[model samples]
Target: MTGEEGLRACDLTLAGLLHLLLRSSHHSSSKLTIFAAQQAPPAPGSRRQRHPRDAKLSTATPSYIYIPTTITKPSATLPSTDDTDTHYRELDLPSFFNQIPSITMDHRPQAWGRPRDDVYGAYNASYMNPNGPNQATQAPIVTGTSVIAIKFKEGVVIAADNLASYGSLARFTDVKRLRKFADSTVVGFGGDVSDMQFLDRHLQSLDIEESYDLSTDQAPRLNAANLHKYLSKLMYKRRSDFDPLWNHLLVAGLDDAGKPFLAAADLLGTTFTSPSLATGFGSALAQPIMRRYVPDDEAAANLTKEKAIEVIKECMKVLFYRDARSLDSYSIAVVTKDGVDLKENEKLEKQSWKFAERIRGYGTQVV
Candidate 1:
């Protein structure tokens, strides 16, 4: 029943009705009482007759937090009709919306200041079927932006600026969405942060020997390079099937055979391998810089760890200066056949507006 109808039928004020309701239900619950193994029921005529279904339970621990359970969290029910139908019945469970008969709007548009909103559209009811065919998300909602990866001599270094934007909002920074798969694969994510998360969970389920329904050897092991190749294939297959991962991923690591490996996969399921790879704006600005260091088979074969690293750093600085979405601070990860080493907070040195002061147009320098 609506509170007003209940109060008028009982001939009580609002406050009085609420107080009585609380007192009755709170006393009846016996929430804090400690009971022994067996307890006796009161006689049929007794004021507080015990329910036969109630069972004694152990009270090893009691919560002290007082969370309101009545008005604050009440079961849904049919509204009280009028002053004549005043008595309230506590529902054993919430009434299902479908079970309620057709409810017509009353004369009062809205009791409080709430909007009297009505939805008028045909609702498709078959979506809940267990045997329903598979469906994919229509469009990405939350998404990561750019992921850039470069190869060095000792290993591969991949970095992604932590930005999960909602369309143009740039909503979430510090969303470290990049994940390392196994030994050799560091999956750097760009585009659709939620899709990245969904893929993360999906990958977590892939190596079944670790997660579920398996009984055998278990180890602190990952296979990121292998995982990367699989993802490339998966992305392309999904695109072919008319669904896509909606993420641009850069996988940096060594192949199973211990060769330096860096590859990328995109929403269209396109795949490419290089000494360095980037997605989004980085693709245009950073690729040429990386290619200078690892330009061809001859260059990549001769790439020393220090030179490779220097080239990557130079590329990052260029990206920071060029890509509006790029940041001075980023996460860098190195993966080799040995292991994966990731640095979440690496900042650029000497990045300041002091350079602007020395430039031609600080105030009115160009004369």
Candidate 2:
């Protein structure tokens, strides 16, 4: 056969195979009949006989069907009214909408599941004020009133009441504000009690670090002066960040040279050293009494430890009478060359209001 006839045969064979494949495939829906070059009819009486399969292939028209590439998913059927009723009955509709909606006209969103105001009281929304500046501690709450201290020849004597007041209320009576650092230093804290706790924990960690260094290098522990500097820097850093620790701290101990050391650091990181130092109401109430004895560095140098303790006790007594936040019970510490002599629970002696009974205008007294 000629090359042209072979090409025509190849085309016809390909079309026939495609038609068979399309017919067998279940996906094909649209049929495309392709008419290839038909074979010439045999001459009359040519004596050529065709096979039955070839005859069938010649008689049948070859076509290509287009099948969609995507498979169609079965459509979902709607539930009958009876089934729908059963489902509705099974659902917990009340639980689904259990939260009480807010009736206020304001656009602010409600805390839906919170207890009603009549039962659990209204929630504090002061912290949620969007217009307020983002800041730490607008003012201190649950505070200590005063910390009083006096310097002497040997060391420093400092005292603070054990009472932590919640505004005007004496909430906690057994909270000691005096913390001893290492063996030599005693720190007296006055101001926010919560901030005091934070500083206390921070100091404890610092003490641990100092202890490790002391063990390794056999170096002397940090003295009162060093600790005071560290605390002042920490306070100043926090203040710079606008998150100052609301505390007035008085550090008392022997200096690095084994001399007496006493200094004060406030929330703003202000530092000052004096023969007599007091914070809060102590600055107004107890300072006069302490300064009467140890007024200057010269007097402090001449003053004995016994004389200092006596003066501190007298100041404490004065504060107990004058300062409303002051308490009869207090914690006092005397830091000297030897170690810290601390008494966490000390009471005023012979404290009484019996004298007021004799006055004419006293309680239940007739004018």
Candidate 3:
């Protein structure tokens, strides 16, 4: 045989060997079918000639032949609804994926912007919610009306009513809004009572820490000016984070120089210092009354402590009558060099609607 015929015979033998190997290892689950090219049979009575390459092809298997096989997974058996005739059902992927979470349909104000419970499961009882930004208070409930404060010759005096109104309803009447920090400072809160309580707790913890750190008598305590600065920074930080404390505060006491210090801070961290300061409705009603006596530092320096207390009490009485949210029962504090003297249960004396009896259209009177 010629050398070309021997080469053709070697190629044909390799193709036949590959085809045989594939057929032997074929899987029943596979859909692939491979066919080897058919070559013409050798001439009648002609002997086939072998090539040296055919020796290698005979003993060695081709490394390139690969047949992909399919894996058959067993079908899951679903529970028979007809056999049980029950409404209960197991959690399934289809239902979990398709059904709307209940949090999405909640119409309550507090549930606003909550994530889909189906995707993240129920929200953990924590300050943070997963997959969403932390929520801050948008509206205040259970709120105090106003806080009034005045700096006098000796020190400062601050006052707030005991009423915590729920919407228009007067809900809690005995909530004291005055907090005495250390001995020289008094803090008065106005606005949301809950936020006020939170701040109160925070201040208490801070006071404990300060006391523990300043064990020596020579170490000066945190004065009203420093405390006011700290609180202002805290409020501003919370405001920057879009989670402000929903309360207006009045910090009253002696400053580092032992002079009376009076300042105010609101939810936005806006602050101002005045001889007489008032928040909420007091800014409109009682402010005018207090400013008449202690309008500036000169007036405050001239005003006596006894006269300052009387003026604050009169303003509270006026607030109780003019401000609907104000209460006849209130708390008052006087901070002097001596210390803070706080009265939490002061009541308006002889305050009533009897004066309206003199008006022609008052009560059942004619117009």
The lDDT for every candidate, in the order shown, is 0.60, 0.74, 0.74
Instruction: For candidate 2, give the lDDT.
Output: 0.74
> Mind giving the per-residue lDDT tens digits that candidate 3 earns over 100-181?
3344543323455666566567877665547765346778878999999998899998999899999999989999999999
Give the top-scoring candidate (TM-score): 3
Native-referenced Cα lDDT, model 3: 0.74
lDDT of 3 at 337: 90
Clash pairs, candidate 2, are: none
Question: Which residues of candidate 2, in runs, are more than 4 Å off?
Answer: 1-135, 216-220, 352-367
Worst 10 residues of 3 by lDDT: 84-93
Clashes of each: 11, 0, 0
Error (Å) of candidate 3 at residue 220 is 3.8
lDDT of candidate 1 over 1-367, digit per residue (tens): 3322322333224234334544655645423221221323233454322223343233222211111112221323423223222122222211212222344422221223222235334434487677965457557777765677776666777877766767766677688867866444678888877678878888767755444533445534445566676788888888888877788888877765677777888877777887778788888988877877777655776777667666666677777776766666777777766788887777776555555667776687884
TM-score of each: 0.56, 0.62, 0.64
